[model samples]
Target: MTVFVDTSAFLAYLDRSDENHETAVATWTQLLHNRELLVCTNYILIESSALIQNRLGMAAIRDFQELFIPLLRIEWIDESVHQTGVAAWLAANRRRLSLVDVTSFETMRRLFINTAFAFDQHFVEQGFSCLK
Candidate 1:
């Protein structure tokens, strides 16, 4: 199964200062050991990298990418996905959620990936199993 690596999880993994670092690290280790397939979109990677740089530092973000990017099956979705994501955002709870979040949801729905490795409650609200 290919787990959708959400920004929340990516942040948790990269920022050791995070409150969820322990849990995220444990889960990450387990997943890696189990050889669980992983996936993400360029949408997620861009946001995640920026957040990592802002919250932690540019050095950390660079290091994280060196270790993480090759591990993911990046879904470079197109303009169609962006259009669908925009619609999903409007239909979702509010415009508070970003295109990355909405697109992650839409992409998951389209790919039939029911499990999302996310700390965001929106995933659960959207009827997907959030891997804590």
Candidate 2:
């Protein structure tokens, strides 16, 4: 199975101090053992990398580039994806979702991926099963 990876899960997996770190690690290990295909959008990578660089420092970003970048297949966000995300973002009123979250949702829908490696409740609310 292919699972869409979100920034929250990535951050938790990389940072030991995160609240969901243990769960993310265990889930990641299980996915790896099961040979599940991991996928992420370019927007996700950008957000994750920026968050890691700003909060965790350049070394953390470097580690992410070296250790995590090669494990997953990247789906580059094109004009269509951006437009879809913008539409979703504008349509959402009750939910305070970020552009990245909407973009991820669009990417997942486009790829027919229902499961997400995420720690965000937004994914759950969007009817996507978040795997901690």
Best by TM-score: 2
RMSD of each: 1.2, 1.2
Candidate-wise lDDT, in order: 0.87, 0.92
Each model's number of backbone clashes?
0, 0
Over 4 Å off, model 2: none
TM-score of 1: 0.94
Which is the leading candidate under lDDT?
2
Per-residue accuracy of model 2 over 45-65 as CA lDDT, tens digit each: 999999998889998898889
Scored by Cα lDDT, where does model 2 land? 0.92
Model 1, C-alpha of 57: deviation from truth (Å): 0.8
- Model 1 misplaced stretches (Cα beyond 4 Å): none
